[model samples]
Target: MRTRVLAASATGALALTALAVPAAQADGGSGDIRITKVVVDGDNKVTIGTGSAKTFSVSVTATDDSGIAGADSFTLAGPGYGFESTGKPSCKKVSATTSTCTASVKTDPRTDYLSNAMAGTWYVGVWIDANDHDYVWKDKAGSFKFQRGSALTTNASPEPVKKGKTLTVTGKLSRANWETLKYGAYSGQSVQLQYLKKGAKSYTTLKTVKSNTSGNLSTTVKATADGYYRYVFAGNSTSGAITSVSDFVDVK
Candidate 1:
């Protein structure tokens, strides 16, 4: 579906600040108006970087006996804060009484001030109205993983080393801090050292190393042939996974 970016700023921010999941979940209205499913970013994993705002799609499927009219708004709440804007739902009829509405929503770095602690599970709050004046409101309709964009970098030393000589690989793991609007170290996480031989189709994991307190990584591997070496981080719940740029080392 076609989607557009919607950022919360100024008045929009002020309005959405009151969004909350009262007692976790609730629904209202007659005629059986109900929210069936909500999909955020396809797999429900939103990864926002320090660059431009990340625009994501939200699909809300609802059913009503009198036919679905549309949705009112969509709010995302997490940790200590929340953000939302009036959803411009594009409704598609699934049946006589069911319609799926989708909208393009976004979390912008320029206006939305988010902290590191806010990266985790976030709940979606919405309201749906039907054609026959029936409506329903849900405080916590669904939830998804909200994560920070992570990055990894690598560099292998000693160019053109002997075939059996040890090559030192060094790198760092960092992620976007939405509040500070900067990339910060992601310390004490396990990262893998992978190698891809020249002319090889894929890379193979050589060994694993954990990032230091400063998110620095250093490891040694015996150079066997001309190949590329890189670092990969399998991220946790609050951060997006990433792979470092491949560094090629030529061996004699």
Candidate 2:
């Protein structure tokens, strides 16, 4: 999406914070295989109302202190069941004593290929090169799984705001792309607006309102000063942070 950059001071620090499984047997030899940690960035856990092309950074780490004599190579395989993998995993050598690698993947990064894939539960599996068939490293594999929530692809544009004029900021909301949970649980969800003065040190809440049956929400944002203002639309809690801002306006 297109976003307008503003000169407003950041209200607070921004925190940028993925997949799956397989039918592979564990390596009885214990080659120090593991998934160090999983990092989910940009609305990973909560739904923003509209279907979002969430981006995640998955990191996998492997180490071998068993004195195994061989070239320790690793590979990652995800059923991808229905979701899409941005590209091949980006591998890196964290350390000789400890081998580590990381990859960046997204459920749906582009709006062009939305229907080509299904939003469902997917599996991610990691493999180590050893005595395995087809060099598949099936002998040593680890797996994890996660669900994709509902998502919205509706197009939106920044609404124009007049300087010193109070404008009700309103927009649509949708679930995550892989959302399969019953809508009843998430229906009537609310979208929060976070507002702050231009160049201010902190952000304050403007309003909190639930979406209409059509998944639309509206709230007012008062332009405190004539210079500039930016607000974000988010779901759940006061932490509703806006990922983009409206267009700048000349008060005079």
Candidate 3:
């Protein structure tokens, strides 16, 4: 009698399992909306300077068995940096089941829309609403890095120096500070000093020096030949590379 009761319980469990499979399949097969591809600014990575407005182009492709038309809407949200979209997207049908949407968003760090956006790896999110169904995809357009802008300046004193005399060079390295909206000293970073002889088309590295607490650089070298001296900052992950204008010094 106990074995029969156990068999009955097993049979009831099978019946309930049979009913659950069809419901799961229905939910999985009901939707035809899918995001095929997403591209941001024609590349997977992008960089923009703070306080500067940069237009980012987003390209999205979607497909639906019901035929894409005016009833469907699409949007591309970016940076994954806690910003929301306040505008509608524009889309156009390309074929019976495929549609392509093009949209643009301006990244302005000074505005409310992106005031809290921080520099780092950020992603783009795509959403599609069609036939009373909503489908969302994040990071489909890949990721990008936003970095600070940097600048470098150099000056070689005593424009004309005797061949045996010492030539003094001074410069500064700075990078954009988002909080201050101005360029500030980027201290304790290594920068390369390069020299190009009068007839040489390429500049060769002379030495490397670290910026002081104030981002100031000063170095002296014996005058050799008439050449142009410049400082080059290779930049860090958070800043963009910069090269100072060449300062020409004549050696007599």
Best by TM-score: 1
The whole-model C-alpha lDDT of candidate 3 against the native structure comes to 0.64
Residue 40 in model 1: shift from native, Å? 1.3
lDDT (tens digit, per residue) of candidate 3 on 1-252 = 001111124345412221111111112223667777767677644455555767766667778876544322223223323323314567788887777777766655454223223455544455555543544343334445445678899999897999989998999998777556677888999999999999998999999989999999989888999999999998654567789999999999
Q: Number of backbone collisions per candidate, in order?
A: 0, 22, 0
TM-scores across all candidates?
A: 0.81, 0.48, 0.62
Q: Measured by TM-score, how close is model 3 to the native structure?
A: 0.62
Candidate 1 lDDT over 68-101, as tens digits, reads: 9888667666764544553678899999999998
lDDT-superior candidate, 1 or 2 = 1
* lDDT, ranked from best to worst: 1, 3, 2
True-structure lDDT of candidate 1: 0.82
Best of the candidates, lDDT = 1
Could you tell which candidate, 1 or 3, scores higher by TM-score?
1
